[model samples]
Target: MSNNNNFRLPYFLLLLILLSSSDFLPSVFAKSQNPITDSEIKKKKSECYADIDSGLWGGHCKSSSIAKENCALKCLSPACYELIYESDPLEEGEKDYIRGQEYKYCMYKLSVGESLEGVRGSFDY
Candidate 1:
């Protein structure tokens, strides 16, 4: 029990740190006339299409054109979000899909503004 408590301590502290630090979190939105350029979107979509040509999803998701299109669309919409969500520490299980969910929310906000986090000046999340 003590050992378990010790393990939980760091996780608890990390959670606390993340929750309390404003700088650590991404911005909900930022003002931009156009956050995503059409050319940029096209480029991403093309890159995503190219990527699907050789990945595991290609072999597995190819038969289902809808699934393939959805996967590619996800990759292109928010490239970073898709990559991060796909590679999040938490795998697909229980509440592990939070990163993906947050990414979706982030995308929605990004569609409206350029900066996800209005952190005065910084590009990282």
Candidate 2:
């Protein structure tokens, strides 16, 4: 009887884990399916611009023209945002500046009717 109880406890725990994981996996898949839309991009850029004009700049950017410009570019392109903000931090130096310029150029190209593939080369790095 003791051995049977132990066996059942492990199985019960495994079942609980699997059940909870199954519930979580579907939501992750659903979120991944919902891609960003053009309207959403426009709305975000408008909000960023408004923040810049009001000296807020999305609460993350610095209070300066160049910083505000970069913030707007981040709003314009998700890829740019990920590259500039999401990636690992670097020591503030020439490399950082060059990478920032590259991201800015990518976002600018996208704004000027360039294909995302053309601007970014690929969606994934």
**All candidates: CA RMSD (Å):** 15.4, 9.7
lDDT of each: 0.58, 0.61
Question: CA shift at 66, candidate 2, in angstroms?
Answer: 7.9
lDDT of 2 by residue, 1-125 (tens): 99999989989998778768967667645434445456766687888788667766455565555566566766566676675554553332324555565565665555554444543333334
- Please write out the lDDT profile of model 1 over residues 2-104, one tens digit for every residue: 9999999999999989877786554433254455566776787678777887784557546555556657656765454454444533322335344545555
State the number of backbone clashes in model 1. Answer: 2
Q: Candidate 1: where is the Cα deviation over 4 Å?
A: 1-34, 56-58, 78-108, 111-125
Overall local distance difference test of candidate 2: 0.61
Q: Which pairs in model 2 have colliding backbones?
A: none
- Record all residue pairs in model 1 with backbone atoms less than 3 Å apart, i.e. clashing: 27-116, 27-117
Assess every candidate by TM-score. 0.37, 0.41
Q: Report the Cα lDDT for candidate 1.
A: 0.58
